[model samples]
Target: MLTAPGSLKAECSNCGATHTPLWRRGLNDKLNCNACGLYCKLHKCLRPKSMRASHGEGRRSGASSLASALSALASVAAPPPSSATPVVEVVSPGVSSAQCYNCHTTATPLWRKDEEGKTVCNACSLYYKLHGSARPISMKSDIIRKRSRHDARAQRSSLTEPPSASNTPGTPSETPSASPGVSRRPRPV
Candidate 1:
């Protein structure tokens, strides 16, 4: 709330000192105490009786303006909103964005949506199957076989890779060996 000049007498909330408004003419605008030497800030001061009434009137005027604006808005026809309430989009499980809640593994080729709406890997699903926790209504035998083959190939490749320098000490430096009956040496041009 604001007031006309000389209408408000500000009292400090902290020190209980009453002060008249001091309008700084040049570089500063502050109200300083004649008694306690305290500075009174404009926003910190509570609204005076006249100031409150003036602010109340201003608020009423603003409300009337807003009401008039809303009525003006009602005159124009607008297309119906697609949905009254904003639809919260839910991401489907086993999509690229979906991660396993248990293992934090990014699902590849997507997984079947379990009853609890979770994306579970084949291994986890098999475990559940073994435990008789739940059975899938339909099974894809081809996918299961493909997944097994892929896993086996991955395991083999990992095993074939040479141990890192940190893992093996005093081991001879090794490069790729030629295949059986194949020579790596350069042939005559």
Candidate 2:
């Protein structure tokens, strides 16, 4: 049902994307697809064509079915062990399967102790520390957000890089223009 305007019939100048939710301008005012434009804006370079996805293609593919079939065939073709031994797992005394005191969730990336020395999940502990109160149960979510961490070396190199003439200290371009849907916060001194 979604259709592009007649003027947008041309493919993206960078990634050659024929379809995009939104069109954006890139270097030299060239027409770039949404993904390419965002990538270029963040990295200050054109997006690599290798990262482009085929239209209507998905992450799941025939290769996964072939891999499953091969695994099943291998399991059937292999002989059973001559002697089967019972496997036992030993848990250390210091480690306990404790649930978070606040959220009551058993799973967490890290566990921390509350003011009363009760086990609490990382999120609950951090929230309580920042807000000085227990995190609302209504705010709990099943999905965990993955964050991309920058390498220390890359961070150091960027910090050391000389500022361009347009973005030099005290220049009008020193402060970045606010992008739509993104909030700008002043850095702590």
Candidate 3:
């Protein structure tokens, strides 16, 4: 009858015979069958535990001891599932999406992108002269439209002014000449 040390039944797959399973000390020595003449493949019974425990440098022989060590190591190493608190990311409303011009931080309010694809914040834009010589900053659509309108008004006023009358040949001299008054006689003598 294939039985473990404490009445545990062990069956041999090869011979269809049952025998008492011995406490496996190591590979190649776990079971002995008198009827079919087969020795227990200790690997079948004890190799898995040995493999788990033998991952360390030290060798462990008994299956029970290896299993115990593995269980203890798992308990020590594995982290418990946490249910304490949930993490959340907060975004503020009405804030500028542009980051700081000098620093790449997302904190600055007046972030603008230049034609060269540089993102400058208000502080950086004000301090650094990237507009005059360098490429102009890309403004928001609403701001661009407002600036266009203002420029159009200025152009229209400039065009409406007539050319100066001084350009004509018959134009009178604007400089005033002294009249033939009585003031030229030697100060009433």
TM-score of each: 0.21, 0.30, 0.19
Worst 10 residues of 3 by lDDT: 50-59
- Ranking, lDDT, top scorer first: 2, 3, 1
lDDT of 3 at 77: 76
Put down candidate 1 lDDT per residue, 75-101, tens digits, no spaces.
554655687755646777644655554
Count clashing residue pairs per candidate: 0, 0, 8
lDDT of 2 by residue, 56-114 (tens): 22122558645654664665574754568534466698665678889888767889999
Clashes of 3: 8
Please state the error at residue 17 of candidate 1 in Å: 86
Model 3 score (lDDT)? 0.46
On TM-score, the leading prediction is 2
Candidate lDDT (C-alpha), each: 0.46, 0.71, 0.46
Which one wins on lDDT?
A: 2
Question: Candidate 2: misplaced stretches above 4 Å?
Answer: 1-96, 150-189
